[model samples]
Target: MRCEEIRELLVAHADGELDDVERERVDSHLANCPACRRERAAFESTGNLLSLLGPVPGAGRSISARVMATVRGEDPWCGHIRRELTAFVDGELTEAEARPVREHLATCAACAAESRALERTGDALRAWKLPSMRIGLARLFAPPRARGRLLRFAAALAAACLLLAVGIAFFVSESGTATPPPGLLRAMEMLDPATLEILDQDPGLLEIVRDLELLESVTDEEVALLTLNGSGG
Candidate 1:
Protein backbone atom coordinates (compact mmCIF):
# COMPACT_ATOMS: atom_id res chain seq x y z
CA MET A 1 0.00 0.00 0.00
CA ARG A 2 1.01 3.63 -0.50
CA CYS A 3 2.21 5.69 2.52
CA GLU A 4 -1.12 7.57 2.83
CA GLU A 5 -3.16 4.37 2.64
CA ILE A 6 -0.82 2.64 5.12
CA ARG A 7 -1.09 5.64 7.50
CA GLU A 8 -4.89 5.46 7.47
CA LEU A 9 -4.65 1.76 8.47
CA LEU A 10 -1.96 2.35 11.16
CA VAL A 11 -4.42 3.21 13.94
CA ALA A 12 -6.80 0.34 13.19
CA HIS A 13 -3.82 -2.01 12.84
CA ALA A 14 -2.41 -0.83 16.18
CA ASP A 15 -5.76 -1.50 17.85
CA GLY A 16 -5.90 -5.02 16.30
CA GLU A 17 -9.03 -3.78 14.56
CA LEU A 18 -7.77 -4.59 11.04
CA ASP A 19 -8.48 -7.85 9.24
CA ASP A 20 -5.55 -10.28 8.66
CA VAL A 21 -5.10 -9.20 5.01
CA GLU A 22 -5.09 -5.47 5.84
CA ARG A 23 -2.81 -5.99 8.85
CA GLU A 24 -0.38 -7.94 6.68
CA ARG A 25 -0.38 -5.14 4.09
CA VAL A 26 0.46 -2.52 6.74
CA ASP A 27 3.08 -4.83 8.24
CA SER A 28 4.74 -5.25 4.82
CA HIS A 29 4.77 -1.49 4.31
CA LEU A 30 6.13 -0.80 7.83
CA ALA A 31 8.91 -3.37 7.45
CA ASN A 32 10.52 -1.27 4.67
CA CYS A 33 9.38 2.24 5.69
CA PRO A 34 11.03 3.71 8.81
CA ALA A 35 9.06 6.99 8.47
CA CYS A 36 5.75 5.11 8.47
CA ARG A 37 7.03 2.99 11.35
CA ARG A 38 7.69 6.13 13.41
CA GLU A 39 4.26 7.55 12.57
CA ARG A 40 2.66 4.26 13.60
CA ALA A 41 4.52 4.47 16.93
CA ALA A 42 3.14 7.99 17.50
CA PHE A 43 -0.46 6.84 16.79
CA GLU A 44 -0.07 3.97 19.28
CA SER A 45 1.41 6.31 21.90
CA THR A 46 -1.47 8.76 21.46
CA GLY A 47 -4.00 5.94 21.82
CA ASN A 48 -2.20 4.83 25.03
CA LEU A 49 -2.19 8.39 26.39
CA LEU A 50 -5.91 8.81 25.69
CA SER A 51 -6.61 5.50 27.45
CA LEU A 52 -5.12 6.90 30.74
CA LEU A 53 -8.54 7.71 32.28
CA GLY A 54 -9.01 4.06 33.31
CA PRO A 55 -7.70 2.67 36.60
CA VAL A 56 -4.36 0.99 36.00
CA PRO A 57 -2.15 -0.48 38.71
CA GLY A 58 1.04 1.36 39.74
CA ALA A 59 4.41 0.48 38.20
CA GLY A 60 6.33 -2.42 39.73
CA ARG A 61 9.25 -1.64 42.15
CA SER A 62 11.69 -2.72 39.44
CA ILE A 63 10.37 0.04 37.14
CA SER A 64 11.78 2.97 39.17
CA ALA A 65 15.12 1.20 39.72
CA ARG A 66 15.46 0.58 35.99
CA VAL A 67 14.40 4.13 35.18
CA MET A 68 17.02 5.49 37.57
CA ALA A 69 19.69 3.23 36.04
CA THR A 70 18.75 4.42 32.54
CA VAL A 71 18.87 8.07 33.74
CA ARG A 72 22.41 7.31 35.00
CA GLY A 73 23.30 5.94 31.51
CA GLU A 74 23.70 2.38 32.78
CA ASP A 75 21.69 0.80 29.89
CA PRO A 76 22.38 1.24 26.15
CA TRP A 77 18.84 0.53 24.82
CA CYS A 78 17.19 2.60 27.57
CA GLY A 79 16.32 5.66 25.45
CA HIS A 80 15.52 3.85 22.18
CA ILE A 81 13.41 0.98 23.58
CA ARG A 82 11.60 3.24 26.03
CA ARG A 83 10.43 5.24 23.01
CA GLU A 84 9.26 2.08 21.16
CA LEU A 85 7.65 -0.14 23.90
CA THR A 86 4.21 1.37 23.42
CA ALA A 87 4.30 0.43 19.73
CA PHE A 88 5.63 -3.04 20.52
CA VAL A 89 2.78 -3.85 22.96
CA ASP A 90 0.32 -2.56 20.38
CA GLY A 91 1.80 -5.21 17.94
CA GLU A 92 2.84 -2.45 15.56
CA LEU A 93 6.35 -3.89 15.09
CA THR A 94 7.52 -6.56 12.63
CA GLU A 95 9.13 -9.78 13.96
CA ALA A 96 12.67 -8.88 12.84
CA GLU A 97 12.41 -5.40 14.38
CA ALA A 98 10.71 -6.56 17.61
CA ARG A 99 13.17 -9.45 18.35
CA PRO A 100 16.00 -7.23 19.60
CA VAL A 101 13.61 -5.18 21.75
CA ARG A 102 12.16 -8.41 23.22
CA GLU A 103 15.65 -9.82 23.92
CA HIS A 104 16.76 -6.62 25.60
CA LEU A 105 13.63 -6.28 27.75
CA ALA A 106 13.96 -9.92 28.90
CA THR A 107 17.44 -9.32 30.31
CA CYS A 108 17.06 -5.67 31.30
CA ALA A 109 15.27 -5.17 34.64
CA ALA A 110 15.03 -1.39 34.20
CA CYS A 111 13.40 -1.52 30.73
CA ALA A 112 10.87 -4.14 31.92
CA ALA A 113 9.92 -1.82 34.79
CA GLU A 114 9.60 1.06 32.33
CA SER A 115 7.33 -1.06 30.10
CA ARG A 116 4.99 -1.89 33.05
CA ALA A 117 4.79 1.82 33.96
CA LEU A 118 3.77 2.65 30.37
CA GLU A 119 1.02 -0.01 30.56
CA ARG A 120 -0.34 1.63 33.72
CA THR A 121 -0.26 5.05 32.08
CA GLY A 122 -2.21 3.71 29.09
CA ASP A 123 -4.78 2.16 31.44
CA ALA A 124 -5.36 5.42 33.37
CA LEU A 125 -5.79 7.34 30.09
CA ARG A 126 -8.65 5.04 29.08
CA ALA A 127 -10.82 6.20 32.02
CA TRP A 128 -10.26 9.97 31.95
CA LYS A 129 -13.04 12.33 30.70
CA LEU A 130 -12.51 15.87 29.45
CA PRO A 131 -14.80 18.59 30.86
CA SER A 132 -16.86 20.73 28.42
CA MET A 133 -16.12 24.45 28.15
CA ARG A 134 -19.03 26.57 29.55
CA ILE A 135 -18.47 29.64 27.36
CA GLY A 136 -17.80 30.11 23.61
CA LEU A 137 -14.11 30.73 22.74
CA ALA A 138 -14.69 34.31 21.46
CA ARG A 139 -16.78 35.33 24.50
CA LEU A 140 -14.17 33.80 26.84
CA PHE A 141 -11.41 35.93 25.31
CA ALA A 142 -13.29 39.27 24.86
CA PRO A 143 -15.52 40.93 27.46
CA PRO A 144 -19.11 41.84 26.33
CA ARG A 145 -18.76 45.53 27.43
CA ALA A 146 -15.60 46.00 25.37
CA ARG A 147 -17.08 44.12 22.39
CA GLY A 148 -20.27 46.25 22.50
CA ARG A 149 -18.28 49.53 22.51
CA LEU A 150 -16.13 48.36 19.57
CA LEU A 151 -19.24 47.29 17.59
CA ARG A 152 -20.98 50.63 18.29
CA PHE A 153 -17.91 52.60 17.13
CA ALA A 154 -17.74 50.56 13.90
CA ALA A 155 -21.53 50.96 13.28
CA ALA A 156 -21.38 54.71 13.82
CA LEU A 157 -18.46 55.09 11.38
CA ALA A 158 -20.28 53.01 8.74
CA ALA A 159 -23.53 54.95 9.22
CA ALA A 160 -21.68 58.24 8.60
CA CYS A 161 -20.17 56.99 5.33
CA LEU A 162 -23.53 55.53 4.17
CA LEU A 163 -25.41 58.81 4.97
CA LEU A 164 -22.79 60.90 3.14
CA ALA A 165 -23.09 58.64 0.03
CA VAL A 166 -26.92 58.88 0.00
CA GLY A 167 -26.85 62.68 0.46
CA ILE A 168 -24.25 63.20 -2.30
CA ALA A 169 -26.23 60.96 -4.72
CA PHE A 170 -29.48 62.94 -4.07
CA PHE A 171 -27.75 66.34 -4.49
CA VAL A 172 -25.95 65.27 -7.75
CA SER A 173 -29.28 64.04 -9.29
CA GLU A 174 -31.12 67.25 -8.29
CA SER A 175 -28.46 69.98 -9.05
CA GLY A 176 -27.41 68.65 -12.53
CA THR A 177 -25.51 71.95 -13.09
CA ALA A 178 -22.43 74.00 -12.05
CA THR A 179 -24.29 75.01 -8.87
CA PRO A 180 -22.97 73.25 -5.73
CA PRO A 181 -25.03 71.59 -2.94
CA PRO A 182 -25.87 73.84 0.07
CA GLY A 183 -23.02 72.26 2.10
CA LEU A 184 -20.43 72.71 -0.70
CA LEU A 185 -21.79 76.22 -1.69
CA ARG A 186 -21.02 77.48 1.82
CA ALA A 187 -17.34 76.41 1.49
CA MET A 188 -17.16 77.54 -2.20
CA GLU A 189 -18.44 81.06 -1.31
CA MET A 190 -15.34 81.56 0.91
CA LEU A 191 -13.02 81.42 -2.18
CA ASP A 192 -12.40 84.36 -4.57
CA PRO A 193 -14.77 84.64 -7.60
CA ALA A 194 -11.75 84.08 -9.96
CA THR A 195 -10.92 80.80 -8.14
CA LEU A 196 -14.60 79.84 -8.22
CA GLU A 197 -14.72 80.45 -12.02
CA ILE A 198 -11.57 78.28 -12.47
CA LEU A 199 -13.18 75.56 -10.25
CA ASP A 200 -16.47 75.77 -12.20
CA GLN A 201 -14.63 75.18 -15.49
CA ASP A 202 -14.17 71.50 -14.32
CA PRO A 203 -17.40 70.49 -12.61
CA GLY A 204 -16.20 66.86 -12.35
CA LEU A 205 -13.13 67.79 -10.23
CA LEU A 206 -15.23 70.13 -8.06
CA GLU A 207 -17.87 67.41 -7.54
CA ILE A 208 -15.23 64.81 -6.51
CA VAL A 209 -13.54 67.16 -4.03
CA ARG A 210 -16.97 68.24 -2.72
CA ASP A 211 -18.03 64.60 -2.17
CA LEU A 212 -14.72 63.78 -0.36
CA GLU A 213 -15.14 66.84 1.94
CA LEU A 214 -18.74 65.87 2.71
CA LEU A 215 -17.67 62.30 3.60
CA GLU A 216 -14.97 63.66 5.92
CA SER A 217 -17.43 66.07 7.57
CA VAL A 218 -20.01 63.26 8.12
CA THR A 219 -17.34 60.97 9.52
CA ASP A 220 -16.15 63.65 11.97
CA GLU A 221 -19.72 64.36 13.16
CA GLU A 222 -20.28 60.65 13.86
CA VAL A 223 -16.94 60.44 15.72
CA ALA A 224 -18.08 63.42 17.88
CA LEU A 225 -21.24 61.52 18.83
CA LEU A 226 -19.07 58.52 19.82
CA THR A 227 -16.96 60.85 22.00
CA LEU A 228 -20.08 62.19 23.76
CA ASN A 229 -21.30 58.63 24.41
CA GLY A 230 -17.93 57.86 26.11
CA SER A 231 -17.37 55.03 23.59
CA GLY A 232 -13.91 56.52 22.88
CA GLY A 233 -13.14 56.28 26.59
Candidate 2:
Protein backbone atom coordinates (compact mmCIF):
# COMPACT_ATOMS: atom_id res chain seq x y z
CA MET A 1 0.00 0.00 0.00
CA ARG A 2 1.24 3.47 -0.84
CA CYS A 3 1.76 5.98 1.98
CA GLU A 4 -0.96 8.31 0.72
CA GLU A 5 -3.50 5.49 0.49
CA ILE A 6 -2.53 4.28 3.93
CA ARG A 7 -3.14 7.78 5.33
CA GLU A 8 -6.62 7.65 3.86
CA LEU A 9 -7.26 4.27 5.51
CA LEU A 10 -5.37 4.77 8.77
CA VAL A 11 -8.33 6.29 10.58
CA ALA A 12 -10.63 3.45 9.63
CA HIS A 13 -7.95 0.86 10.35
CA ALA A 14 -7.22 2.20 13.82
CA ASP A 15 -10.93 2.40 14.57
CA GLY A 16 -11.31 -1.31 13.77
CA GLU A 17 -13.51 -0.53 10.81
CA LEU A 18 -11.19 -1.96 8.15
CA ASP A 19 -11.53 -5.54 6.92
CA ASP A 20 -8.80 -8.05 7.79
CA VAL A 21 -7.01 -7.68 4.43
CA GLU A 22 -7.12 -3.89 4.64
CA ARG A 23 -5.86 -4.05 8.18
CA GLU A 24 -2.95 -6.19 6.97
CA ARG A 25 -2.05 -3.68 4.26
CA VAL A 26 -2.06 -0.81 6.75
CA ASP A 27 0.09 -2.86 9.08
CA SER A 28 2.50 -3.68 6.27
CA HIS A 29 2.72 -0.05 5.19
CA LEU A 30 3.11 1.11 8.75
CA ALA A 31 6.07 -1.22 9.12
CA ASN A 32 7.93 0.59 6.32
CA CYS A 33 6.81 4.24 6.48
CA PRO A 34 7.36 6.10 9.77
CA ALA A 35 5.80 9.29 8.40
CA CYS A 36 2.62 7.53 7.39
CA ARG A 37 2.63 5.80 10.79
CA ARG A 38 2.78 9.20 12.50
CA GLU A 39 0.04 10.44 10.20
CA ARG A 40 -1.98 7.41 11.24
CA ALA A 41 -1.29 8.21 14.87
CA ALA A 42 -2.33 11.81 14.25
CA PHE A 43 -5.50 10.57 12.58
CA GLU A 44 -6.23 8.37 15.58
CA SER A 45 -5.66 11.33 17.85
CA THR A 46 -8.06 13.36 15.72
CA GLY A 47 -10.62 10.61 15.96
CA ASN A 48 -10.22 10.56 19.71
CA LEU A 49 -10.64 14.32 19.78
CA LEU A 50 -13.75 14.08 17.62
CA SER A 51 -15.10 11.33 19.82
CA LEU A 52 -14.76 13.66 22.76
CA LEU A 53 -17.10 15.95 20.84
CA GLY A 54 -19.65 13.14 21.35
CA PRO A 55 -21.79 12.32 18.33
CA VAL A 56 -20.65 15.03 15.94
CA PRO A 57 -23.34 17.63 15.62
CA GLY A 58 -25.83 16.70 12.95
CA ALA A 59 -26.51 18.54 9.66
CA GLY A 60 -27.97 21.39 11.73
CA ARG A 61 -27.25 24.18 9.24
CA SER A 62 -30.12 24.57 6.80
CA ILE A 63 -29.09 24.13 3.15
CA SER A 64 -31.48 26.88 2.07
CA ALA A 65 -30.17 29.41 4.61
CA ARG A 66 -26.64 29.80 3.16
CA VAL A 67 -27.91 29.25 -0.39
CA MET A 68 -30.27 32.20 0.03
CA ALA A 69 -27.66 34.21 1.96
CA THR A 70 -25.12 34.05 -0.88
CA VAL A 71 -27.84 34.26 -3.58
CA ARG A 72 -26.27 31.20 -5.21
CA GLY A 73 -29.31 29.00 -4.40
CA GLU A 74 -26.89 26.10 -4.04
CA ASP A 75 -25.53 24.59 -0.84
CA PRO A 76 -21.75 24.73 -1.28
CA TRP A 77 -21.67 23.00 2.08
CA CYS A 78 -24.26 20.52 3.18
CA GLY A 79 -23.07 18.66 6.30
CA HIS A 80 -19.96 19.41 8.32
CA ILE A 81 -16.57 21.08 7.80
CA ARG A 82 -18.29 24.00 5.98
CA ARG A 83 -17.24 23.14 2.40
CA GLU A 84 -18.77 20.62 -0.03
CA LEU A 85 -15.74 19.19 -1.85
CA THR A 86 -13.48 19.41 1.18
CA ALA A 87 -15.88 17.23 3.18
CA PHE A 88 -16.00 14.81 0.26
CA VAL A 89 -12.20 14.74 -0.09
CA ASP A 90 -11.88 13.83 3.60
CA GLY A 91 -12.66 10.16 2.80
CA GLU A 92 -16.44 10.51 2.87
CA LEU A 93 -17.29 9.05 -0.55
CA THR A 94 -16.91 5.28 -0.62
CA GLU A 95 -16.43 3.03 -3.64
CA ALA A 96 -20.13 3.27 -4.41
CA GLU A 97 -20.61 6.80 -3.14
CA ALA A 98 -17.63 8.12 -5.10
CA ARG A 99 -19.22 7.34 -8.45
CA PRO A 100 -21.19 10.60 -8.61
CA VAL A 101 -18.07 12.61 -7.72
CA ARG A 102 -16.16 10.70 -10.40
CA GLU A 103 -18.81 11.46 -12.99
CA HIS A 104 -18.82 15.13 -12.02
CA LEU A 105 -15.05 15.31 -11.97
CA ALA A 106 -14.98 13.90 -15.48
CA THR A 107 -17.18 16.69 -16.77
CA CYS A 108 -16.37 19.61 -14.45
CA ALA A 109 -12.87 21.08 -14.96
CA ALA A 110 -12.98 23.27 -11.85
CA CYS A 111 -13.90 20.39 -9.52
CA ALA A 112 -11.41 18.09 -11.21
CA ALA A 113 -8.54 20.54 -10.72
CA GLU A 114 -9.54 21.04 -7.11
CA SER A 115 -9.52 17.28 -6.60
CA ARG A 116 -6.07 17.07 -8.23
CA ALA A 117 -4.76 19.75 -5.90
CA LEU A 118 -6.04 17.77 -2.91
CA GLU A 119 -4.37 14.62 -4.25
CA ARG A 120 -1.09 16.51 -4.75
CA THR A 121 -1.19 17.74 -1.17
CA GLY A 122 -1.71 14.21 0.04
CA ASP A 123 1.14 12.99 -2.16
CA ALA A 124 3.51 15.61 -0.78
CA LEU A 125 2.63 14.56 2.75
CA ARG A 126 3.39 10.94 1.87
CA ALA A 127 6.82 11.85 0.40
CA TRP A 128 7.93 13.04 3.83
CA LYS A 129 6.17 10.31 5.79
CA LEU A 130 8.37 7.63 7.36
CA PRO A 131 7.45 4.11 8.42
CA SER A 132 7.49 3.56 12.17
CA MET A 133 7.96 -0.16 11.67
CA ARG A 134 10.34 -2.88 10.53
CA ILE A 135 9.12 -5.33 7.87
CA GLY A 136 9.75 -8.96 8.71
CA LEU A 137 10.76 -11.51 6.03
CA ALA A 138 7.33 -13.14 6.12
CA ARG A 139 5.49 -9.83 5.55
CA LEU A 140 7.61 -8.76 2.53
CA PHE A 141 6.35 -11.49 0.19
CA ALA A 142 2.66 -10.62 0.10
CA PRO A 143 0.14 -10.11 -2.69
CA PRO A 144 -1.88 -6.94 -3.22
CA ARG A 145 -5.42 -7.65 -4.47
CA ALA A 146 -7.98 -6.64 -1.86
CA ARG A 147 -10.93 -5.44 -3.99
CA GLY A 148 -11.30 -8.68 -5.98
CA ARG A 149 -10.65 -11.03 -3.10
CA LEU A 150 -13.20 -9.22 -0.91
CA LEU A 151 -15.76 -9.35 -3.74
CA ARG A 152 -15.22 -13.06 -4.36
CA PHE A 153 -15.25 -13.86 -0.67
CA ALA A 154 -18.47 -11.91 -0.24
CA ALA A 155 -20.00 -13.69 -3.26
CA ALA A 156 -19.12 -17.09 -1.84
CA LEU A 157 -20.51 -16.15 1.56
CA ALA A 158 -23.72 -14.90 -0.07
CA ALA A 159 -24.05 -18.09 -2.13
CA ALA A 160 -23.56 -20.24 0.94
CA CYS A 161 -26.17 -18.18 2.81
CA LEU A 162 -28.59 -18.53 -0.12
CA LEU A 163 -28.05 -22.28 -0.18
CA LEU A 164 -28.65 -22.50 3.56
CA ALA A 165 -31.81 -20.41 3.28
CA VAL A 166 -33.07 -22.56 0.40
CA GLY A 167 -32.30 -25.72 2.34
CA ILE A 168 -34.18 -24.40 5.34
CA ALA A 169 -37.19 -23.42 3.28
CA PHE A 170 -37.21 -26.71 1.35
CA PHE A 171 -36.93 -28.87 4.48
CA VAL A 172 -39.56 -26.78 6.23
CA SER A 173 -41.93 -27.24 3.31
CA GLU A 174 -41.11 -30.94 2.75
CA SER A 175 -40.87 -32.46 6.16
CA GLY A 176 -42.21 -36.05 5.99
CA THR A 177 -42.42 -35.84 2.20
CA ALA A 178 -40.14 -38.55 0.90
CA THR A 179 -39.95 -39.63 -2.74
CA PRO A 180 -37.83 -42.19 -4.59
CA PRO A 181 -35.89 -41.47 -7.75
CA PRO A 182 -37.86 -41.81 -11.03
CA GLY A 183 -35.56 -44.57 -12.27
CA LEU A 184 -35.99 -46.56 -9.09
CA LEU A 185 -39.77 -46.11 -9.30
CA ARG A 186 -39.80 -47.30 -12.88
CA ALA A 187 -37.63 -50.32 -12.04
CA MET A 188 -39.97 -51.17 -9.15
CA GLU A 189 -42.93 -50.93 -11.56
CA MET A 190 -41.11 -53.24 -13.98
CA LEU A 191 -41.03 -56.05 -11.42
CA ASP A 192 -43.72 -58.28 -12.91
CA PRO A 193 -45.29 -61.28 -11.12
CA ALA A 194 -42.88 -63.95 -12.49
CA THR A 195 -39.80 -61.79 -11.88
CA LEU A 196 -40.92 -61.09 -8.34
CA GLU A 197 -41.41 -64.84 -7.70
CA ILE A 198 -37.95 -65.63 -9.09
CA LEU A 199 -36.44 -62.91 -6.90
CA ASP A 200 -38.40 -64.10 -3.86
CA GLN A 201 -36.98 -67.61 -4.31
CA ASP A 202 -33.42 -66.35 -3.99
CA PRO A 203 -32.47 -64.01 -1.13
CA GLY A 204 -28.65 -64.37 -1.28
CA LEU A 205 -28.26 -62.55 -4.63
CA LEU A 206 -26.39 -59.32 -3.94
CA GLU A 207 -26.20 -57.74 -7.42
CA ILE A 208 -29.35 -55.62 -6.96
CA VAL A 209 -27.13 -52.57 -6.56
CA ARG A 210 -26.59 -51.81 -10.26
CA ASP A 211 -23.60 -49.56 -9.58
CA LEU A 212 -21.37 -52.60 -9.04
CA GLU A 213 -19.06 -52.15 -12.07
CA LEU A 214 -17.93 -55.77 -11.89
CA LEU A 215 -21.53 -56.87 -12.48
CA GLU A 216 -21.36 -55.32 -15.99
CA SER A 217 -19.06 -58.25 -16.87
CA VAL A 218 -21.32 -60.81 -15.18
CA THR A 219 -23.00 -63.52 -17.26
CA ASP A 220 -26.62 -62.99 -18.36
CA GLU A 221 -27.64 -65.88 -16.15
CA GLU A 222 -26.01 -64.31 -13.11
CA VAL A 223 -27.59 -60.96 -13.90
CA ALA A 224 -31.00 -62.53 -14.17
CA LEU A 225 -30.42 -64.44 -10.94
CA LEU A 226 -29.30 -61.28 -9.09
CA THR A 227 -32.22 -59.22 -10.46
CA LEU A 228 -34.67 -61.86 -9.33
CA ASN A 229 -33.00 -62.15 -5.93
CA GLY A 230 -33.25 -58.36 -5.42
CA SER A 231 -36.97 -58.25 -6.38
CA GLY A 232 -37.71 -61.18 -4.08
CA GLY A 233 -36.31 -59.24 -1.13
The Cα local distance difference test for each model comes to 0.56, 0.49
Q: Residues 1-233, candidate 2, lDDT per residue (tens digit)? A: 67777888887887899999999988988998989988888878888787676664676478767666555323342211124455457577676766667676676555667677565443332232112111211132245543333223222222322333334334434652222233432343244445444443433324223321222333466445435534444
TM-score of each: 0.26, 0.23
Error of 1 at 38 (Å): 76
Query: lDDT by residue for model 1 over 196-223, one digit each (tens)?
Result: 3443333234234233333333345543
**Model 2 poorest 10 in a row by lDDT:** 129-138
| Cα-based RMSD of candidate 1 | 33.5
Error of 2 at 146 (Å): 88
Query: Which residue runs of candidate 2 sit more than 4 Å off their true CA positions?
Result: 54-233
Best by TM-score: 1
